[model samples]
Target chain A: MLKKILYSLTAVLILVSIYLVFFYAPIPVDPKSAGGDPENFKIFYFHLPIAISAYLAFAIVFVSSIMYLKTKKQEWDIVALSSAEVGVVFAFLTLATGSIWARSAWGAYWVTWDVRLNTSLVLFLIYISYLMVRQAVDEPEKRARLSAVFGIVGFLGVPLSFMSIRLWNKTTIHPVAELNYSTFSPLLTTLITNFAAFFLLMASLIIFRIGVEHLKEKGNEMKRKNSL
Target chain B: MKFLHIAWKDLKAEFRTKQMLNSMVMFSFLVIVIFSFAFGKESSIYISVIDRKIVDLLAPGMLWIAFTFAGMLGLSRSFAGEKEEGCLEGLKLCPVDRSDIYNGKVISNTVLMFLMEITTIPLFIVLFSYEIKNIPGLLLVVLLGTLGFIFVGTLLSALTVNTRTREILLPVILFPVLIPVILSAVTATGVLLAAGSIFEIAGELRILVIFDVIFFIVAQLVFEYTIED
Candidate 1:
């Protein structure tokens, strides 16, 4: 019942958020020199939420991974694996959309050493490697145990990646406002609404992915039984 | 410490076999040679050693490439003998904490990595025709940098050791984490080589120290997870 409500709420909220983002959010004048920044800055609304969603997904993966280690429960491993897969997808979306924003805003398709881009790329690579680690192991128990470690290690990356700015004292091209931009703008309501909607979407996506995993495992078990 | 004893055993084993030492040295040398040729063909006009402007730009990058790529070869194979002879299993079956095993490999790998660096530094100098203005500073960077690299690399090599495609996976996984270390190390070395003041490179050095400490503690903490089934 809760899951059904979440799914429907996500669908409605996302549709409303889309309308608000496109038609309602008052595009800001770049505080640095008025009339600066392209209207493509609209991408900020979508991009930031997606990026935070990916981090949230990773946070889930970290917790689920630790839970799996403590309990060795099959369900915990399932949750960790599902959340990581969802997180990676969100991460890629974050990258793809950010690059589109960059092309218009930064006047380049890519910037090699920019802190925000570089760190996100690293975060993406670490989880991709986490998934790859899962592929390389065959035994179910071993794969789960090993991937949990990788998952935990990979979370260390989130802070490291986010702290790249402070670590090197590099400037970011990403539009970070002096205050959290959400509060400053009239679009604040829409942004908060969108965040809540994305959170629901993430929860539904993870639960659905876990269902898929369980079904696949059952099918594998059936095949083994038939062969035996 | 039990970890020290395990490290001593690896050292003794390595001393008798000379396997890890020999392969790591040869690979490091070959890597330097390849870079020399590639730089000669590619970067010579742009970055000749006489032209300090570009020499400092490319040299640290080249040096670290040699260290890490050659280091990968050693790290990938560090557990080969144990894997094949079932020695790791024997070690696991023994009544000691598994992290001691991890710490032991960390010590041994660090020693081997330092050896590779010391041996290759002269080769890098000779090949690049680079004068070392700040030998101590450069060596200090190498020590701290390799300390960071080996902690993460050794932890990952252990994690990937049991997998079939580890040779390729080690770098794929290790390289990203190594970025901060590589950036700071290469930049610091570049500064030192350019005769930049010690104060100029201190920031990079501090970053390397921070990375080393963080990676070491994390590696030690998560090690048991990697060893368990």
Candidate 2:
């Protein structure tokens, strides 16, 4: 019951934050502005946070993979799978929001050799492969173990994917710098609040996914008992 | 010692069959031919005159592309062949450490890759009209790059061999994670081709070395779990 309440609270926070982002926050200065137009600035507030959250999701998967390897327990496998599922969701969101941002900023929807873009595409494919590998094998234990190993290996690409832009000299409008605290106004405050809210939303989604997996495991156990 | 013994056995088997070597060599020749035709006759002659630099620039990409595809072919066959022959279960039940199995597989894969590189470098020179200047640096990059590929490939092949779409799945599964290595190799080769001082390409070289170390450690650590029932 308490878990249910926490989950509901997290959902509310996320919804309210989304409302604030779209309706209440002041429009930001246009990133392209030589003089400071603000129409295109709105994407940054939403887009940056979602991209960061996607990375956070991958980090969670990486940590959970290490835990699974160390403990060799099924619960950690659940955590790893949950994190991977959420990572994929956030990764998809990142790509979508980024493409929109790119259209406004770069005047195009996609670029293939762009290192960050390619790496993200690759990361998404790797996770999809992870899911496929799990489905391909029939033995549950073998599936879990193999998936965990792949999860760990695949996460190695995350940093490479993230850093590929810097390494390859690709152009992106996203600023790689600390936010200027002095520039903060109510709009910045709201953006930060929304950022925190989305992160909590990601956490809640991962928790829900783990809970679903736990219940499925229990159902399998019960069916086995009945058969016996 | 035990790992080396197993690795030796794989080498012996490879020598007897020559299947992986033959395919990789043929594929390398095919890629060079395609590149030559794509470049056309005059450009091909010019490229051959500047052959050393062009080959140096293109070699890592060509080498890795060939190696990656050939490695995939080898990897799928490595374990699937074992399973089909009913040898994998027996091998697993033996007293060998799982890491030994990984080492053995890597050794054999690396040997095949090395052979392919050795055979193809001459063929690339002849077919592409590339002069083999800076042989030492070229060989060094090939060695490091191949080791990195084999390190990751061994583990991925192990995991993918059991999958339903093992052949198609290995490259998708392997390439994304190995991009850093591939990128560094490409960059380093380009730098070397431009006659950039060794100092200039050092950054790319360092990245390759770092990836090689990280993947090596991770592969060794994870191989046990991947192979376990």
Candidate 3:
């Protein structure tokens, strides 16, 4: 019942958020002066939330990974794997949407001088490697243990990569969109609504993925019993 | 410590066989030579237009490519011997902690990486006719940078050893996490090469130090997990 409610709530929030982002929020008047496109800036509504959701997903992976290693529970490993898969998708979306926004806002689809872009690229690569690590291992127990170790180590590298890239390129072309929430603007409302929507969407997807993993495990168990 | 003995055992065996050391040195030598052929005098036109010596500009990047690519070769093979003779099991049967095994591999890999670097740097100097303005600062950057690389590399080396395609997976997985070390190290090397003082590279130095320290601790904590059966 909770899962069904979560799925429907996510659907409603997403529809409402999309309406708010397109028709309700006010577009900035002075975007170009600040390196933003007046229209393309709307992508920010989805882009930032998607980026945050990716981080949230990876944070879940990190926590679950630690829990798996500590408790040796199959559920934690399943959660870690599910969250990592979802996180990788969200990360790729973040990069793709970011590139499209950059094309209009920064005059380039990709900018090496932008620390955020570089860091996001590294984050994407690290998690993709996490998935790759999963594929390369055959035994279920060993795979879980090794990937959990990688999940921990990879999370630690993100901040250092960000710092080093920022230090390496002292100049940045990435715009900082500072929203004024003091007046309770429609923009702020839409942004917050989208954040909730994406978080719910992430949760719904993870729960679904977990169910699939359980089914797969059951199938494997049955196959083993039949063989015996 | 017990880890030092493990490291010593590796070195003693390596000294007797000289297989990995020879291949690492040769691979780095080839990397530098190929880079020289590709980036040497032919780009003089572009270099002239830019009013900077191409060799001076590209030397640090070239050096680190040689270092990392060669270092990757050594790291991928670091656990091959242990896997072959059930040596990993024997090592596990010993009376030391699992982290000791990790530290031991890190030391041996660091030593091998340094040996590779020690050979490659002079060859780089000769091939590029590169002159170092600050030797000690450069060496310091190289040391911290190499530590960060080996700290993470040795951990991932063990991690990948359990994989089916260990060789291919090592570079793909290791390089992204290694961006910080390679970026900071290459930049610091550039600063030192351009006759800049160590003060100019304080930011890069700090990044390298933090990366080395963080990965050292994290890898130590998780090392046991990677080696588990």
List lDDT for all candidates, in order.
Answer: 0.81, 0.74, 0.89
Q: Quote model 2's TM-score.
A: 0.90
Q: Write candidate 3's Cα lDDT for B134-165 as tens digits.
A: 88888899899899999999999999999999
For model 2, residues B10-40, the per-residue Cα lDDT tens digits are 7888789888778778877787677767655
| A1-228 per-residue lDDT for model 2 (tens digits) | 967877888778778777777777776454542123355556667776776787788777778778878887888778878888887888888788778767766676786666667767777777876676677777776777888888888888666545543465566445454556666566777788778877887888888999999899899999999999
The most accurate candidate by TM-score is 3
Question: Candidate 1: global Cα-lDDT?
Answer: 0.81
Docking level of model 2 = medium
Provide TM-scores for the models: 0.92, 0.90, 0.96
Worst 10 residues of 1 chain A by lDDT: A29-38
Model 1, A54-92: lDDT tens digits are 989989999988898889898999999999999999899
RMSD of each: 2.7, 3.1, 1.9
Error of 2 at A54 (Å): 1.7
- Give the RMSD in angstroms, all C-alphas superposed, for model 1: 2.7
- List residue ranges in candidate 2 displaced over 4 A: A30-37, A111-115, A161-165, A221-228, B46-63
Which of the two candidates, 1 or 2, achieves a greater lDDT against the reference?
A: 1
Could you tell me how far off, in angstroms, the CA of residue A109 lies in candidate 2 after the best superposition? Answer: 1.5
